[model samples]
Target: MVLQVSDSDPAKWNLALNNARNIQQDLGKGNVAVEIVAYGPGLGMLKRDSKVADRLAQALDNNVDAGVVHIMKRQREAWAYVRP
Candidate 1:
C-alpha cells in the first residue's frame, strides 16, 4: 500500500505512520509492503530535526519504505501529474 502525504503537518505524519503500523499488524509481518511518499512541505516529516523523525525511523525499522520527492517549485501541484 502507498501512503501519499503532501503536507508537512505533524498530524498527517502521525496518521500515515499509524496507518502503516495498522497494515503491518493486520498482515502479520512481511506479508505486505507499505510505501510512504512525501513531497512538498511533507518532506520535513522525514528530516532528522522534525518532531516525527523518531516515528519515521521506527516505520523504517518496521520495513516501511519512505521516500521524498524533490521538485523545483510547487511540489504539491506537481503531484497532479505523477502517475502511479
Candidate 2:
C-alpha cells in the first residue's frame, strides 16, 4: 500500500507525519510505502531555507521523501502545487 499525504497546513503536516508513524507501527509486519508531497504554501514546510527544515530533514532521514512540484510556471512567475 502506498500512503500518500499532502496538505497545506503546518498543523496538518504534523498530522500527516503522525499518521505515517502510526501506519508504520501498525504495518511494520507488512509491506507498506509512504510518500509525502509538500507543495503550495505547504512547500514552505519543506523549504531549503525553512525553520522546519530540520524536522523535514529528519523525516527524510526516516525514509519519507519530501518532494515539490511546480504545477504552474511562467517566464515571470512560478506556482508550486501538490495533491493527493
| Candidate that scores best on TM-score | 1
lDDT of 1: 0.67
Task: Supply the TM-score for candidate 2.
Answer: 0.55
In lDDT terms, which candidate is top?
A: 1
Q: What are the RMSD figures for all models against the true structure?
A: 7.3, 8.8
Model 2 off-target regions past 4 Å? 1-8, 48-51, 61-84
Model 2's alpha-carbon lDDT is: 0.53
- The parts of candidate 1 lying over 4 Å away from their true place are 61-84
Candidate 2 per-residue lDDT, tens place, 1-84, comes to 232334556667776677666767888826555555554467666777765566677767433233333222211243222233
Per-prediction TM-score to the true structure, in the order listed: 0.69, 0.55
Candidate 1, residues 1-84, lDDT tens digits: the string is 666778888987888888878878998657876666776678767789998988888777432233443322225544322212
Q: What number of backbone clashes does candidate 2 have, counting pairs of residues 3 or more apart or in separate chains?
A: 0
